[model samples]
Target: MRSIAALFSMLMPGVGQMYNNQFVKGVVFLIIEHYDNVFGSINKAIHLDFNGAHAEALKAVDYQHLLFYPGFYAFCVWDAWFHARAGADKTKTAIIFLVGGFLGEFAAIFSTHLPIPSLTCGLVMVIPMLAGMFIFRKQ
Candidate 1:
């Protein structure tokens, strides 16, 4: 059961915890990170292009030769990696971090309306892991 939470974290960062019954934490992350990151990036995409087709046609994002779409790929990996080495409370911790991640991204989104919720959510989610860090450190 705990492993399932960790696995979900790996797949979507905070999804594991939410599924594990950490609804509050899960909602926080979803709102904070995923919403903002995706929206923010897409918002940028909309503005970066002069016409709809320009942004639409540019299926690839290139910033100094680095190209990647904004999503849960990295966070999923992070959640999995960290959770793998995590303790018994990995699921609980995943939920909190997921919440924090969501909060941070929500802040960003509300401030700029940039659609950065998704990317920011992933980046900020690890913050709530402090709870897990404390939990693990106690042992």
Candidate 2:
């Protein structure tokens, strides 16, 4: 159940909350997700990034809005996982999300130096997140 919830969130931010019976929170997250995507040009950037148009991808992104995305994404995943876990120890979860968020932001900041700057942020961010999930599952 917990893994399912996390997976739902991984697909879309609010879906897992909805699965957790948090309709209002889920709706809010959905709104935030849309807002962030549009303002950040995240979809456009990712498309360009994957197409190897690194310059265009960088130009497409609105850094101010994009910068907030990693933390928000991490939080949504953590929220669903926390609820699904039904009061699992929060310390590890918090640490995992926090680190993921920070690393995501850090990667975004330094992505300009990488060959695939736009995609780098997402890749770096997801690494810790997936690792955290596996770590939690083992406990």
Error of 1 at 105 (Å): 16
Q: Candidate 2: which stretches are off by over 4 Å?
A: none
Per-residue lDDT tens digits of candidate 1, residues 1-139?
Answer: 4445655664554576576666776666666555654644544544444343443423422321111222243344335434444354555445554565456545434423434433444356444554444554432
Model 2, range 17-128, lDDT digits (tens) per residue? 9999999999999999999999999999989989999888989999999899999998998888888866588887778878888988998887778888766787777778
Candidate 1: which stretches are off by over 4 Å? 42-139
Give lDDT: candidate 2, residue 52: 90
Which candidate leads the pack in TM-score? 2
